[model samples]
Structures are given as structure tokens and as C-alpha cells.
Target: MVDIKSWIFKDCCLVFSLLCISIVGITTGDQEVLTNSWLVELSEGGEAAARDIAKRAGFSYVSPVLGSDTEFHFIHNAVPKTRFRRSILHTRKLKSHPFVKRAVQQTGFVRSKRGYKPLKGVLLSDLHINNPEIGQLINDEKDVVIGKDPTDPLFDKEWFLKNRGQSGGIKGLDLNVEAAWGMGFTGKGVTTAIMDDGIDYLHEDLKYNYNSEASYDFSSNDHFPYPRYTDTWFNSHGTRCAGEIAAARDNDVCGVGVAYDSKVAGLRMLDQPFMTDLIEANAMGHMPNIIDIYSASWGPTDDGKTVDGPRNLTMRAIVKGVNEGRNGKGNIYVWASGDGGQEDDCNCDGYAASMWTISINSATNDGQTAGYDESCSSTLASTFSNGKSTIRDAGVATTDLYNNCTTTHSGTSAAAPEAAGIFALALEANRNLTWRDMQHLTVLTSKRNRLFDPYLKHFWQYNGAGLEFNHLFGYGVLDAGAMVYMANHWKPLPERFHCTAGSIKKEMNFGTNEPITLTIDTDACKGTDNEVNFLEHLQAFVTVKSSYRGNIVMHLTSPMNTTSMILSQRPNDDEHKNGFTRWPFMTTHTWAEAPRGTWTLRVENIAGKNNEYDDGLFREWTLVLHGTRDPPYHHQDADEENQTKLFKVKRMHDMAMKN
Candidate 1:
């Protein structure tokens, strides 16, 4: 009988595991449920009414489930159920029903009113389709063909100096190579992987920066990574993006790049101007290499819902890389937020909405007067470029696929690579840092004040302080120097502590004056000396019998040493005032002042209702904690050696796990 019981338990465990796996697969799909519209609950007397309404609306499907007394679950198609015209009518009619409670539009799939239109002649044509027109415009005009003389006032000498003269800046632009180099983000030894259309690996300006050993043409599974010059058509979008990210610097040749010292890994997944899911999938499969950053300047149109279709497989693969790929040492995934800000809401959801990806928005040059010039009240400008003179922020000078130096381009696609280049600098600063830590630090330390434009109030509404994280600017504009400061001192926050009396649903009896020790364990604490100040990163509160009146004591034990006893009384009156200080809970204190290691927190109910406590009298209380560490300054000096060692260790651990 005992053996039979054991077998039953084991079978139950297996079933539970399978169920969990299935749920994960569903929730993490590329087409995730974005809105709660498809969820509905039936009332006792309204069951028939709800079904009739759904059927009349042409939902084609429905499922029933129990919920709150006033709410219930009526599952239907996860996507919008009503036709465009019907949806308008439904909204107007639903507003009249008192018992209907509420009706919302579901968002599980993207709804596109029109299909994708490929770029004519540009991406689909052979050879240079615009060559004749360009030739006619610049016939023997050396200044127009190349640029104004080196002494031209309009020439960007600052840009030239900053890019170390490798880029073709306006003749007199002063380049600040010293300032850029002083920041320690030369992009040396970093590998940036570009997942887009094929690039011209042979382009003179970009050829020196290409990591030929690391480059791949996933679109055709061939050795050629250049755009095919068939007939009169050629698409060099990918090549242009690559050049902007890491084109060779100080070569005294063409255009400059953000990270001139970085190596470029061109991974072609788009053919000419078209995107293919199959090719993306194939490219994703080969991405588990030593890549420091993955830059993708493409995304579906943000249409208020998640995109679905077979192409979703590629997104899933990308997420896998974010969560568990590269042997758990997460890789940074950078994506262009989108270029649909003109008519569509900038916040529309898409691949960039994924928590695993860092979404990049665009900004025009400090001088450009036209284009989508939304104020940067919220997010940071990761990079700058001349708008529309070249291709994709065209004014930003960089190597062209055809080796021609041009400047008319503008789009979020161009902006993302600029951000990716800055990230490469941060990575170069400290390679031991995880991608999450890098992202959080970058956002936290961005130049919020510099990007704010007080002239635009509408764009500043969502911005937290007319400084950081605005709806338009995101964290204000990106600051390479500030990012460097943060990288040198960034740290991860402490994980939240789960304080429960075993099961939340199960009732527990604690008689009045009966001292019960409620133990708390934080899942994120590493219990290592390096993480000793983990507790300093969190804030917590406790309550007994629904009243937040209690005394909490914390004790820590570790291989290094034991912590001194500490106590916190309930009802802390001190409001969180200091920018760097954690808020004091009525009954909470930080661990920063305490010793690090394995720790236990005990909450004692000092006073509350029911002197003779009953099991039903107990209620749950919420605890909130926030913690992070700044990267150490010494890391900057020891970046190369420490980074190499850490990378090897991580690689070995990953290999062992796979074995």
C-alpha cells in the first residue's frame, strides 16, 4: 500500500510538471494576450443573455468559468471579436447596460487594416535604381558628389574629431575623439550582431570593422554577406545600419560611427527589403555565440495588439535567448521601437514591448528642423543623426554600402543602432554585468534634464519629473558619459522576500498573546559576501490580523560572520525623503546596515484583534522591497582581465549544464 501511494505521488508530480510546461509555452508566445477584452463572466440570470450577445456579435466561440460574485469568466476568441462596424455599435450599446458591468476590447492579436507594401525600386530593383538621378544632380560637382571642401563652415569638424576623422563629417566639424576616448567606450573587443538585410562587407569604410570570422548570411545560408547587385536593384539598409554602429574610425576616409573601435557581426535575415520568418528562425538558431549585443532595427507596426503568425517562432527563439540562452548569462537584445509616431500612438505594443528587449526610439540631429520632432521629456536620446539627407537618419554620416558618403536618412531604425553602440561602450566598461543590470543602470543614469524641451507641454504630461522617462523621450536622451559613470558603479537590486504562513488560503490559528515566529526568505539573495548589503536594497512592512501593528526582528547567518540583532517597530512615520535612501516602513528596515549572508526575518504580532485568535481572523499583508547596487569604480581599470575571466567561467558553467 505504501509503495502504491509513492507511485501515485510521483505520477502526480509528473503531471504537474507537464502542466507547468504547457502554461509557460502558452504565456510566452510571440502573440501574447495584450488586453482583457476576451474575458467575460456570466451572471446567474444573465447567462443566456451573455451567450446571445456573443453569438449575435459573431464571436464563433465561448467558454465558461466561475469568478467573483459580481464577475465571472466567459472566454471567447482572444482577439477582437466584433467586426469594425459591429465594434462601434457594441461599444455604444454596452454603455447602456447597468448589469453588463463593463465591456472592453480584447487584444491578443494585431489587427492591420492594410497589408505590408514593399519599397518599390529601392529594395526590389537591381543595381542603383537612383544612380541616374543622383548622377544628374551631382554631375562633376565634386563638392556635391563628395562634400564641401575640408574648410567648409557647414562641415561638422566636431563630429569629425569625435569620430577620430574616420567618418566623413562636414568639412570643419570638430571631432572630440579625446572626450569620447576618455570615457573608455572605444567599443574595442565588443561584437555587435546585426540581424537585418545583407550588408556590403566589402564597403571600404566598413570592411575593416567587420568580424569576417563571425559574420553569416542566414538569409541564403551562403558566405556572401553583401547586398546582391542584381540588374539595377540593391537594398543596403542592413549595410548602412552596420556602418553606423561600428564603422572603422580615424581612417581619414569616409564617415564616422558611434563605436568606431567595435567589431561588427552582420547576420542577414532579410532579403533586400522583405522580411522572412524562416530566415529569422535560422539566424536565431545560430546566435548563441560570444555576441555582446544584438541590434535589430525592425519590428511589426505597433497596432495596439501583439502580432501573430508563423513568424512568431522567431520572436519566441529571441525570447529564449533572452531568458535562458547563452547558458543563462543573458544577452542584450536591442530593437528599434518603431517609426510610426506620426499617426499611430508611440506606445503601441509589439516585439519591443517584450520585457527581454530594450526598445529604442529615434531623435533628429540638434540642427534638423523637420520630421517627427517630439520633445524628449521622458526618455534619453541614445544617439544623434542628420535627418533625411542620406537614408535612415541620413544626416548622420556613416559608411554607405556602396562606399558612397551620403547623409539623408531618418527613422527609429537608425536610432536603435546608435543606442546599441552606447550599450557596447557600457559593456566594454564592465563585461561582468548582466543585461538586466545594464538596462536598469542605463535608464537610471540617463541625462533627463538635457533632453527636456519646456516648449512642448503635451509631451511632458507622462514624464515623471519633466526629466526622466517621458512618453516621447523614454528616459530623456541617452548620455554616453553618464552611462559610463553608472557602469562603473551599477549593482542589482535585492529580490523580494516571500513571507507566508505556508499556504495563503489555509487558515492558521494563533491565540491571543501566542507568539508565532513568521519567517521570511528572499529568493534573490545570493548569500555571498559580495551580496552582503542585499538587505539594504529592500523595504518591507508587516501586518497582523489585518492591522499593521507588529514588531519585526531580523537575523542573518553566513560563512563569513553572523549579523547583530536588529528590530523595527510598526508605524514608521519617516516618509522616504532621501533620493538614495530606501523608505522606512512602519515596521521595516533595510539590510544595508546589517551583515550579509543567509538571513531570516521574524514578525511578532504585538497587538491586534482577537485576544483569543481564531484561524479565520488571520489576513495577508503586502511587503514591498527595492534594492540595487552601483558597479564598482575599480572595475573600469580591471575590465579586460575581469571580463575575460568572468566570460570563461560563465561559458564553462553553461557547457556543463548542457552536458
Candidate 2:
């Protein structure tokens, strides 16, 4: 045996050295000092020359940035702390060096977990009691269990896994993982890394499946990623997430994990004073070959006012993971769409909006959108989370910190791990599945089932491909049984391609009531090597100037006439100074649609009664389509035919519902 864990650790240490750097440019108690760390980018084939230059400049070369070959970190311990001017001069010298391509002093940014409030509306003080509908549903079929039930005491309360109307939930409204488990696909050989605060590897339910070799603490520069102790147990977030993925089955401790036989690794990068570019890069790119999935429930603040995403180094890391990780099959990155509720829009969040990640939202046990679920076109799917009513208080059940178990793992944080676990099972069913393949399986196998937005804030509609999607639920809640069944016979998609179909350079002005409409007609790069006939992901890179940015609402209509709400009004976003600049508003709503006709973009100012500003201008925009030249379902086998049948059935059901 190769001892995969040890191999992964050695590989990580070979090219990644720990840097004892301090926060740069941050003020501590009215004193501001520049740190010694510098992000240095070297010219191609100039490593030796760059090292020589660093030595001459009295700077020690650290390791290469986790995913890049030419970019590196350098430090000067002799003058560890310096004034801003001195640091700037040093940066200028490095950039001016012949071998250096770029150099900048490292700065820190804030990254918050998706669900900061674990018990947003389900606190004990707010709990409802003695309600008729709050009691658990009795299982009538005692002898015909679908899968071997785990003896874990809390398993029954884990309604997301196997809901039998538990806690006033609708029966059968769950992930449907039991049938897949009965088929023996328990994510046996897969490993999922929780990129969060930290994980309690010593927890009884998690210790058996913990892969310590692949675990690391970027916050404290250690191998053990044990979360820091706190009285409020706030740091238990990662552990709770891990338990959702790989907690041992029938352990008499907590509820069984979604992929009970799978392994879990902890990447403790979030329990730090500030998040650095290097730290984010290292965590995402760590042990890519060994870790199959990276489940992140954190992102830029969910406050509807902020619009941010991955910085440069982190962006490079994600691209590298998708292009070169897992022997070129690509690493699966699962993200939690923001929890900003109706006031926020997830398109403003760059991480969830990125095409590379599968953004998951949250649903209640009764198949309704959670109160905190942020609506976005980029959300790929949804999973179960906390749902409180006068009837019952239902939340996720999983392991907690210090050998404890929690029945209230709420938020998108709790929802993402379930998706990760389901993906792990699919990976085990077919190890050759790529990141894109996983996404295809999600779109194909996920079922609308009984999920809906109870408030009707978002409605389910079939796109051009007859695949149903919702801004809140995406394709729908994940169906683990369907996913694994399809994965067993899935074929790898053809090589992916991208084409810039068209661009608009001139600015067009529009008033609050008038809508700005633009069109692009192309063959989707036909007759070229980068031809993209079938659309998988579309990006409308846009630049706009608005007096009040919050009033801006944008929509993209594909050549197939499937309209996508790419951008929506954010009540909290009043930023007018720097309107959107080349922000890629992406959507998977046009999946498998032909991209060879006129595509339309409609920009509206939903200012309505509160028009705080006068007018807006559409500066410039570009339409980029990504897909394969050939039909991705070239091998139209029985699985594909069967899935199409399911779609037809769903379409009929949708029509009846509308009627």
C-alpha cells in the first residue's frame, strides 16, 4: 500500500513552507506597522534568478504560493516590523527587479462563516410547545426498511437524511440517501475536507473517519486542526459540518453521517484574526489528490451591502484545483450560498456566483425555503436546514464540540455538508467523475420532488432544456439515490470549451422606469477550435454606472428564450461611487442550451417609489459561453434516456400545478 495520507502530507510540505508572518498594515491599539511578508511573483523560468535577487536584498525566500509555480512568499526577519513608507519602498524595489514580475506587501481581509447565527429563530425561548402537528410521524412500515438503520440515538431526529414527518416535517421530503446506502455506496474511498474554523477529530463519532495526514491548521501553523476553545462554542462550526459528512455509523453517539464510511479532513484556516490570501490559497489547494471534496460554508459577509469574492491568489488556487487536481479529474468545491434572506442577493457574492463552485442553498424539512436562504440564479441546489414553526422546531442533527451532539446545526452551513456527503457517495460510485461531471449529475439527478418557496418569493420553472429550476432551490433538493444510480453508468463529458460571443463597448443611458435592453448574436465561435455550441455556463461580464446601485435589476435571456435573473435589487446596497465593473454575473439556467442565436440582456431600475437617484448608464458588457462542441450526452445510454423520462414526468407535474 502507498500510505496515501503520508504521501499527501510530504507532497504538501515539499512545496509549501510555513511563514511566520504577522498582519500587515493593521492597526493594533493605535500603532500601525507593516509585516515582513511579501507576495512575490517571478517571471516564467526565473526561479533561480529570483532566489538570487531575494538573497541579495536580504529577504529569505519562502515556499511557492500553494497552487502557482512562479508566485512565492518572501520575508525579511531582520527588519520584521517597519513603517509603511519603508515597506512600500521595499515593494517598489522588488517590483523593479529584473527577475520579479510583481511584488506586494500582504494584506488581510475578513471572511465570515455563512451562518453566524446558528439558532437564528429557533432559540429555546422562542420554541413552541404542546402543538398537535409538532409530534414525530410514526413509521408504519416496520419490516420493510429501505436501508439498514443505524443504532445512533439521534438518527431518527436527522430528518434531512430520512424524514418520516419528524418534527412536523412532510414525510419523504429529504435527501433520499437511504436507498443509495442500501445499494452499498457509502462513500467508502472518498475524503471530504471541511475548510472551516476547525474540526474536533477526537470526537467519538468523527475520530474513526478523521484523516489526520491530510489535515492542517493554517491559522496556527500546526498539523492538528483542533478548534480553539471558547465558552460560547462558536468554533464548533467545522466539527458540526464534519459530522454531517463522515460521522461513524451505528456508533451510539450521534446521528450517522451522510457518507458514514468516508473520511473527513480538517483545514483550520478560519479561526484566525484575519484571512490572508496565502492562507486561503493553501487551504483550497491542500491535498487535492487525496481530498476529493472541499466543503466551504464561509464567504464574504452576507450583508446585502457588500459585493466581493475570491481575491487574486485564491482565484488562481480554485482555477488550479479545477484544472489540475485529482489527476486532472478536478477537485469538487461545494459552497454555501449566503444566508442574507430576502434582503440579500447571492449574485452579489462572488464565491457562490462563480461557475467553478456548486453553491448550495437551504430548505426546510417540509420542503420550503428557509427564512435565511438568499436567492440567486447561481445556486446549483439546496439541502435541508432548520425550519421552525408554531408546529415544531426542526434543525439539522450532528456532532458538536467536546464530544457533544447537537440537534440544531442550522443555516446554510449545515446544508452544504449534506451536499458534500452526497457528492462523496457519487465519487465513490465512479472515481473517474470530474468536477464538471458531478455538476452534470446534480442537474440531472436532483429532483424538485416536493420542494417549494412557500412565500412564493421564487417559483420553479422549466428552462429551455425542460429541466426545472428555482432561484431558491436551483434544480431542486439533491436526490442521493438518483445521483449514485446515474453515476454508476456515467460517461465523462467531452473536453470543455469557451468563447466570447460578443461585447458592447459604448455606454447606453436609461432612466429609472425605462429598461435597457442589449442583444448579442453569434454562432458561439463556430468554425473555430474554441467553439461552444452547447451552453453549460454563461457569464455576462458587465460594467454599469448607477446613482443608487441597489435599484439595479438585470436579467439574461438565452438564445433558447430561457430567461435568468442574473442580478436582483439589493435593498441594502446603496453604493453609487464604483458601480459594477466587469463583474461576471453567471448562471447555469441555460445548461445544455444551444448558444448560436441572439441573446438578450435586460437591465431595469426597480427604483419604484423610492428613486433616491436620477439615472443609470450601462457602460460595457461581454457575453462568454462555456460548453463542449459536441453534445455532452453523446453516449445516450439507458441512464440518460431514463433521466429524460423523469424530466418529462416533472414537466407534466409542473403544468398541472400551474393549472
Per-candidate TM equals: 0.50, 0.85
lDDT of 2 by residue, 300-400 (tens): 77777777777767876887788778878899999999898887888877788888899999999888888888998899998988867454438787888
lDDT of candidate 1 over 1-659, digit per residue (tens) = 01122222444552232111111111123443432233343344365666665665544323232212433233235334323223444443543454566655443322221111222211211212211111121213111132222221112422422332223323222222223345546788887888776777877667878887767775455656767664422355677678777766545445456677888888876553333333454455445556778887765443312222223335545644655444454677786655443223222223454434676665444322124432211123344444334433235444555665444334666677778877777778666666565655555444433333334533432211112244455544565655654576555433322111111222243433444443334333334322322222222222223122222222322212322222222222111111111111111112122222233433343333234232212333223222322222212222331344334323433332243
Candidate that scores best on TM-score: 2
For candidate 2, which ten residues in a row score worst on lDDT? 18-27
Error of 1 at 340 (Å): 0.7
Which pairs of residues collide in model 2? none
Off by over 4 Å in 2: 1-36, 42-62, 67-69, 74-86, 89-102, 118-146, 389-393, 634-642, 645-659
Candidates in order have lDDT scores of 0.43, 0.79
Worst 10 residues of 1 by lDDT: 579-588
